[model samples]
Target: MSDSTTLVYKKKKKKFKIFPLVNAIFFIIVACLIMIPIYRVIISSIDANTSYNFVWLPSKFTWGGYTAVLTRSSLYTPFLISVVTTIIGTFVGLLVVTLGGYVLIQWEMPGRNFFAYMLLFTMIFDGGMIPKYLVIKQLGLMNTLWAVILPMSINVYNLVLMRNFFEGIPESLFEAAQIDGCSPMGIFFKIVLPLSKAALASIGLMFAVSFWNDYTNFKLYITKNKLFNFQIQLRNMVIDSDIPVDDAVNQETIGNAATIIAILPFMIIYPFCQKYFVQGVNVGAVKE
Candidate 1:
């Protein structure tokens, strides 16, 4: 009886995915394109010899550029100002994005759409630069860190991203939280926030970068030289030739060094936040 019927089974085949491999190669090329420029900047900063042309490797190396930037009194104040503004601006920006986003998601709340449309309207049109200046002047924020911080604190784009993320959260979770006698603030702190790590990191990074690299707002509102941030100091050093230079380092060298200092923080920071960052940007892109 066994000999009469022979069982047949087909062997499973392994499929090679060209898309993933192609994606890897594409990303590798992209990464090198990004990293090469950074490598050049770092090498240029360390290179003691003065030359405008880009070099793959430095002929001579020295730390004089970094030392000059770090030790110079002119650069120090601006650098500190940049750091302080970035920290305060990021915290305040997070508060604005989170609260405004949460408030907009409350469907039962009165005038929610009207309030949201008002915020969106500002994105399409705004009071001109003179009026903005007049308003800042009237508020007595001129020449202060707040002048820079407050202008950037309320970004409509970030608020919208956050609102989208909030909308993606299940309505069931909110209902359950309300059933447990959780107030609005309680649900925000205990439930909403715990689910929003990715959004916070991504938006926080955006705010940090914006405030850290801010140039126009500071240059506009801050007429006083003492209030300038590091970018301004770098501009004066590199472009305007306002700051005094040390004999040990060339102006270009100091500029490159300062450039490294300016971008280095984000380079270090981004890798730590990479996982959350990818998720955060794509938060509302897909549906389950």
Candidate 2:
């Protein structure tokens, strides 16, 4: 066929579908619903004379809220505690997850099934709050960051995902490494880890987000104000509801700014790990 005729034929063959158009419209509406509130919060943070009022756009804009939030000594304690706990918590959690997952993959290990079942059982049932509090008190972890950090590492859902990811590794690689006289640990370090970057990144991000946003654990275990995390303090600011009209900025603006600051790390980190997250979620979802 002539080029023009072929082009005409292709154009004729292309029939627009209503489903795709409708789907696009639906997602666009959903995106706007999500982004509009975030945009409003950003505007409110810089707004002068801010209140619990809706701020679609700031009529009077200034950075006073950010300045107050960043410079305030009272806010500094929680921010620092959160940063420290998040870093330590993510590291400890990732270590436990990786090691635990690796152990589950070792078929010949005695009591493997028993241990796995126990882990799943713990997921469904936990010691009641009183017993948990007593344990933390007895262990001398109360009023410390370790109280929050330790519990953050024991997520059974993440454990299950890690095991599935390890299981997805090709059996041939395991047999080949054994034939080469590579110790199990050597194989884990050299072969398994290099292939499991996506899973690691995904699970690490999960752990980081969990630890960073933790308020309940910190509230329950740590009575000391000095050990409180950013989320706990943020809640305080929101509840106080006293906006100082005399000041350049008010608690309302700072509260909104604080909320943004709390979530900003993941906002920066997630885009880098997004591909790995998608791949890891898929790779770890193996059929039994």
Candidate 3:
């Protein structure tokens, strides 16, 4: 066919689908619904008024929430604690998972099947909270930040996903590395690690989120008020009603501020890692 005729045929073949267009509009509405509350909270942080309202644009804007939380409330120390723990936990957890996943995919490792079974076993079973508490107490981790970071550094589900991704890699690449006098560690760092960015970003973000939002662990294991994370303090104020009755300060406003502080890092981090997240989630979801 002539090029002009082919182009005309292709244009004729394209038809607008009402269902897809309607579906997209429906989801867009739902997305806006989900985002409205978050937008309100962000705006409320700078709003001077204590009462929540439906006003998209306030008559007067003030930095009262930010100022109150930062200057008066006990949020600063806990903010620092959360930042430190999240960074450390994410790095340590990623390293452990990446190497562990690489090893699980290796056919020559001794007791590889047995170890994989054991790892999978833990995913299905639980040690219970009492046993976990006892272990932490015995290790002198109580009231310490390590109490939270150590227990959940390696999530089994994330490890499994990482393994599935590594298994998808071509075995010939490993053989080529071996032929080039590359050690197992060298191959992992030089080849496997570089190629596994999607899985790493996905798992790393999971670890960071878990670490950042861990209030129950801190409440259970950490008694020292100074060591509490942002989530822990926020839980105390919002859930436990630990807010003191003070005429000068509004607890509700402070709670809203705390909510923003707790979730802002996640909001910022997701956009950067979202592309990798979608790809990584799909990598292990299908079987060829």
* True-structure RMSD for candidate 1: 3.5
Off by over 4 Å in 1: 1-22, 242-248, 286-288
Q: Give the Å error, residue 73, model 3.
A: 7.3
Tens digit of per-residue lDDT, candidate 1, span 1-288: 353343222224456789999999999999999988888888889888757887998877888888877766788888889999999999999999999999999999999999999999999998889998999999999989999998899899999999999888888999999999999999999988898999999999999999999999998999988989988888877787654566666777777888988888888999999999988987656543
Candidate that would win on TM-score: 1
Winner on TM-score (1 vs 2): 1
Q: Which pairs, if any, clash in model 3?
A: none
* Tens digits of lDDT, candidate 3, 142-164: 98888899888868788888989
Order by TM-score, highest first: 1, 2, 3
Tens digit of lDDT per residue, candidate 2, span 1-288?
899999999988988789999999999999999998898889988887777777677877878877766666777888888889889998899888888999998999999999999999998998888898898889999888899899779888888888898998888999999999999999989998898999988988899899999988988998887778888877776677533334677777878887788888899999999999888877666644
Better of 2 and 3 by lDDT: 2
Q: Which stretches of candidate 3 lie over 4 Å from their true place?
A: 1-7, 237-249, 285-288
Q: Which predicted model would earn the best lDDT?
A: 1
- CA deviation > 4 Å runs, candidate 2: 1-18, 51-53, 241-247, 286-288
Q: Clash pairs of candidate 1? A: none
The estimated TM-scores of all candidates read 0.88, 0.88, 0.86
lDDT value, residue 211 of candidate 1: 98
